[model samples]
Target: MTDTVTLSLADLTARVETIFRRAGMNAAQTRALTSVIVAGERDACKSHGIYRIEGALRTVKAGKVNPLAEPVLDAGEGTAIVRVDAKGGFANPAFELGLPVLAARARELGLAALVINDCTHFSALWPEVEAVTAQGLSAMVMCPSYATVAPTGGNKPLLGTNPFAFGWPRADAPPYVFDFATSVAARGEIELHRRAGKPLPEGWAIDADGNPTTDPEAALEGAMLPFGGHKGAAIGTMIELLAAIMIGDLTSPEVLDYLGTTTLAPFHGELILAFDPARFAAGRPGNPLARAEVLFEAIVGQGARLPSQRRFAARKISESQGVTLTAAEIAGLDRLTAQGLDAVA
Candidate 1:
């Protein structure tokens, strides 16, 4: 059995922030990243939680990610498009810098798009979407990963396990948010399965020889299958253009060539679009959120749970109790802190 240690949310964030600070991230960047990391754990998204710390450190050491990044924003006049250059940093600071602009632009223009480039994105997309929704705007974000998923009917891996997230504000509760990978399962899930020495679910991936396999190790060496067959592949390909090609950043395949191994982070691109429903439905009854609540209640009454409902519930529990971290995770924090801030500087 695996050993675990319980840590309060404050402790977890403080630990994570300390490591990032030691790694040369400024307070703003450290706080932004710490928020994301803590939220992942609070929401029980283990795949995107403390487990990612080691990889983050490695990327910083490898010179693939800049810890002292300052994202620069360029806004177009008379247009709803804003571009953010992450300057080879991680996505957290860029999102922190650009999300406010996205909301403001959406409010001013009724719709806005924020294209983020030259960053390594290593967390779940739900946090970004939910943040926008909290600002009373609808939001969507799409990002491509290092290629680990194959197109339908293609044995070779040509697409990343592209993820897409959407959020809608609610009148009475947290926003209804949903985030998913086009692949049958996220590559991180496969890594977790590998760590646990467990078999993947059927249809998740294939062997190196292109035969379907449940072995996580084999699947890692092979390719992940897209969800819903060709349908998922189509969406994944669309995300490639929206998140990578259109942003003039390296595509998934191009990223794969650069990383040379799936273990490293690929500084890629992300596309986020936000819309102010108030601009469109000014005359609607009770506003967009009230209307959405009616639908949300109806769905729940029909025995269907809204997306992220469980995560929201889990957050409350985590706040009351604590997040459980593995020994290795704690050790990792210790090791990084032991290295001292001067080492990274």
Candidate 2:
């Protein structure tokens, strides 16, 4: 018998939807959650793929996330800021509910921001960024996770592995986009390493005593280091200031205190800014989009690759050939689908 199984993207989505519905998630929650989870699998981003279902279920079982919440949007009638109260649900549905309003405001005002509060966000930011870019606008997204990373020169966890992402639209290709955690490595990557019984790369984290280590378990127990030391730490801090503090939402420390453990997804907020390129360049000489193309071509000519290139390529393959999962992963899915919340702990 084969050791792996491949399912069409539709099939995978249905399976994931079934799992979440069985776990007691509402239609909105399950639909949005399944989209991002399946997108992760389609793009081969295993860290955010089906592997995350257990954590989500655990969060639900712990009463951390509202499985039946319907996100409410505030259009900000006279301002460029739109808002979506996740109402204690997952962030995906809130983002979906706000995107059109955010895009409309950006087109009208040249720029706009979408604030999502009181939600549990666990997926990558690229999907949200790409969604904005698909509207022919530029996008910036950021959110604070629970405290698990230490600031530069610090010995204790103070900052979350906050993620930041940016996207610029392209007339003839996939958008130019990049999304990454400010930490040296995303916490999820460390978890994946631990699960595979592999050592983490050096400089990725510190032991409980503040010394460098390659042990994923030690790193998770202690703290992860920020990328580029001071720079990443500063960026992580900025995310707290903007996405958390300024938005009147929970900061990394507050989230940690509220949850008391990192095992469940953190409760927090998100900030998404959209910019209308044409509106901003109305009086400019050259077309901004065309200029961006030239820059991209030059970069490609230098034998350098663009961000999301690999992901888009993987998406193309998955779209045609379907996503492949190891037998073990399939078994895990089956177990979760059958047991629902009981499969979590």
Candidate 3:
């Protein structure tokens, strides 16, 4: 009954990348795009997993996300923000060309805010946070694009399912990672239910006139409700402001145009903020790292833990028992790759 299947992460990625390249994506683009996809599935964010490859292909087939947009960075911001320019769309804008440059820019700024406009999906935010955390730095990154929902208690789509991710340096175990979308639901989640022919739960979206909706098609056309009603809406708006307004990369008008095109899905106007913890706490001496380690052990020991514990636990289970896949989904993957059941082998 379930439509999920398991495959080795590395093998699945190679085949997926090959398929994308066969579809006309260049090597750089294929690797970048596929890596994000793989990371999502490995981390158990099914919303952004292989389930999204079909949609990503749609955009590619439509020529929306240029598989060749490589990003370039400027490191000379002495006292202000690090500057990045999307290098005329050479490859997809995720980790390959954009996210790395953004992180590098953050390193240069010390207290940096690196922004990327007209970018692609960075996949799961937690990994990104984990990366920055590993560097003994504190970083928060958010991506906001286009409107998908109306204000709380009102029905008028005005913002995307913006997310905020933060990572703090931990002395032991995994660095504390916090990453989640600021909406009640992500569009990716809705797409999953739609693909499986399931109705959505209440409180995820509202209708055209600002009422609630369960029909995925109607929900897609309606406003997405905020996670905490008005409070969530306000935070979502803040993400838009920081990513779009402050960065000046994506705007509402552009979002509407791209939405209509069906070929140009994008994740632009992203803001990445980083601070070097070592710069602040490193000089304190007395093994500052040791002090943080003690605190982390205490918290995780009691199990009042961070954001990604459940996912880690799920991954362990997934590894032991394997992932469950529906026959239909397997068939869909077969169609996408045209490789039949060869992927399983």
**Candidate with the greatest TM-score versus the true structure:** 2
Each model's TM-score?
0.92, 0.95, 0.80
Residue 155 of candidate 1: its Cα lDDT?
84
Pick by lDDT: which candidate is best? 2
lDDT of 2: 0.95
Rank by lDDT, highest first: 2, 1, 3
Q: Candidate 2 on 1-345: residue-level lDDT in tens?
A: 899999999999999999999999999999999999999999998888999999999999999999999999999989988999999999999999999999999999999999999999978999999999999999999999989999988888989999999999998898999999899987878999999999999999998999999999999888999999899999999999999999999999999999999899999999999999999999989999999999999999999999999999999999999999999999999999999999977
Q: Once superposed on the true structure, which residue ranges of model 2 sit more than 4 Å away at CA? A: 191-200, 214-218
Q: How accurate locally, in lDDT, is each candidate?
A: 0.86, 0.95, 0.67
Give one digit per residue, the lDDT tens place, for model 3 in 1-345: 445666776666876786777666666767767876766666677866777677666666655566665566665445446555654332234333434554565555556666555665545666667766776778797877557767787777777777888887775566677887778987778888889889999989887977778988888877778899889888888887887788876654356566663224554666677787555564577665677777777886997776787676766665565555567866766677874223321
lDDT of 1 by residue, 208-327 (tens): 889999999999889999999999999999999889998898889999888887787777999999999999787766767777778887999999998888899999899999988788
Which run of 10 residues does model 3 get worst, by summed lDDT? 88-97
lDDT of 1 at 154: 87
lDDT of candidate model 3 versus the reference: 0.67
